[model samples]
Target: MTRKRINVGLIGLGTVGGGVARLLLEQQRRLSDYLGAELTLARAADRDPALAQGLDLPAGVLVADGAAVVADPQVDIVVELIGGLEPARAFVLAAIAGGKHVATANKALLAHHGREIFLAARQKGVGVAFEASVGGGIPLIRSLREGLAANDISHCLGILNGTCNFILSKMTAEGAAYADVLAQAQQEGYAEADPTFDVAGTDTAHKLAIIAALVTGRQPELNDISTEGITKIAPLDIQLAGEFGFKVKLLAVLRKVGQAVELRVHPTLVPLGHPMASVDGPFNALFVEGDWVGEVLLYGRGAGRRPTASAVVGDVLDLARDVLCGCPGRVPPLGSAAEPEGPLALAPLDQTVCKYYFRFAAQDKPGVLAAISAVLAEHRISIEAVIQKGREEAGPVPIVMLTHEANEAAVQRALARINALPFIAEDTMFIRVAG
Candidate 1:
């Protein structure tokens, strides 16, 4: 290792990529001072030349394309911040092939195609670091894989999506409708114009798949994760959840149940006193339960250019240290060199037994509540509580019920039967309860 400095070539000078550039430039002194090696910002590539105007990088530091950076023999690390499955994957694979350590913040690319990426890096004897993917600045991946390596993790419950959390929090605080709150979230830059990824739960599920794989050594099939978005969440549901001593949160649950793992993401009625219920806004929190550690909570600003860039820079520094030590891949992609024995069984959502909260808009006429209860009884679902006191006179009235622990399949069947009845004014809505 004749080189005393590690050169980092950066791809994408967009929001996050630009931040990474500033950090590498601004924190170069601190990083070199602390790590005892100069971490150099060698090349930055992006199609938009205008994006490089504000970066204040040297004349030749910015390039027109990523190939220049990936092909640069002087570059020791390639940082991919242009998120998506496409050219990013190509760039990363190319970097690994060139024996350059890689760092990225693309959760979707990792979730859908991580296994192949990890394998390629292993073969090339280079490292791939992605601490910025899951929780922006939470330091979650390294903490779990390294800090808590001694403990057998039992479950990980997380409020993982910032956009969804911001919308839900606004809806809860102002008692506003989902669409209105979503629009507000967009106006505030908390959500994208096309929020299907975050609000529809795909974003969170992708990150959870990474966390689950970190724990179980297998990325549970994304389809088997049973995703549900927050688009259906209403202010009325939020009020009802509050009345029921809970708060609605889009939660990602990954837990070990015996030999199987439960991977799920959905709008959950979290108990009011639970830490997750208090985590509102764009902030994120992960509650990890381990055998020896018992319980640990990681909470922080989970998104934004600065925070995410901090995570990316951390990965760059870590990889730089490895490079300086002449020991790349010191920490394997999934925290170990050995491959997982086999794919772990994923617990079916249908088989899950949990309490549920239901909201039914039924005709104000008589016999509706009894009919609904009868259908629930037919499915062997027993009600724990009900709120039928404020029945309106003119239109369909709201009927709320909290059920005792019931089979998910049974609940869905009962809901189907009840929704089909003529007296039911609209489709009944329900949220799984979590504590």
Candidate 2:
């Protein structure tokens, strides 16, 4: 029998969880009218039950245990907003066992244990919708799975972290230090008190794993990705990059090389004319290249209460449709193949080739440039441009340059050798140039 009224059980009443609850309630009539079923919030769970008070949920509808929501026979869809691996994992699995469709935004849980979760849903013949898991509310997953499904996706790169973008944009516009801008972001609630994940690139890497899965039909091991954070970037480097018509953005790159996929994340020097360069201040953008469709870029707010809530609710509606029709897996969870497909061989970073930007803090004295040049030349790395800022007083100065296409291994070796020189600071840094 078709469900005349869909009951939604929500777990987790935190930031995004709260947003989901609000959207579901506020948009109840529209949702019900659209689905042709009276959609209702049957129950909700959170560690702190008091948090649900402000939402004006139906009387006595709030619960303290997620298991209660899962056990409710009336619920046709269970939305898992409680993040993390253990209890969230357990809750989702229990819901699936109960034959309820699941919707989630837990990217880390999905990236780490997606195979198990996806397989479980496939076995149960239920849909696990996660459009909110990456690029919040951007509809990126749907676009990859449905809209652009016809073409072969050759490359995908995104500025997926809003905190990093906000900080970097402030640093670029204000000419302030990274630390100062990070503090400002924290003050403004753009960054967390401990902003390690966002700044360190782990957050973006997690999103990349999901994206690469959609692209290659398999998830790349997190270990296979080369992740470098924005904590080390200095104002001087940003200024130098701008001088050369480039902007620095923490970019997540996944492109096909032969049969293997190359997945990596780091701060990149994007040319000023590129769309990625102009994407600034807490906005996220993804640039995808398909064989037939050419290039497509998606730009959006990426993260926040309402934006994330919008995505989760969208997934909920999709699952609700499947439930009403008694036909699940209308779309695979990963949006590509039904199961995780490839060992999706990830190309070794050492074999990667790209242009690079180098900055060295060296004594303002003769022979420093020649010494650096000799080491780079030895490693077959050629410099394309140079900019040196030094004073007659002969203290430490900055020597910055851009290199032509060179092997990743060669650049690292050359940098290690160059930094080891007596006149050079061991803190010398290098950034990859995006094509």
Clashes of each: 0, 0
Misplaced by over 4 Å in model 2 are 1-3, 338-342, 392-394
C-alpha lDDT of all candidate models, in order: 0.91, 0.90
TM-score list, all predictions: 0.97, 0.97
lDDT of 1 at 336: 62
Flag clash pairs in model 1: none
Q: Candidate 1: global Cα-lDDT?
A: 0.91
| Poorest 10 consecutive residues by lDDT, candidate 2 | 335-344
- Candidate 1 residue 102 Cα shift, in angstroms, is 0.3
What is candidate 2's lDDT per residue for 133-171, written digit by digit as tens? 888979998888888988899889899999999999999
lDDT of 1 by residue, 1-435 (tens): 443888999999999999999999988888888888878899999999999887799878999999999999999999999999999999999999999999999999999888889989988999999999999999999988889888889988999999999999999999999988889989999999999999999999999999988887776676778899988888889998899899999999986767777889999999988888899999999999989998899999999999999999999989988998889999988886678665546999898888999999988777888999999999999999998756646788899999999999999999999999999889999999984
Clashing pairs in 2: none
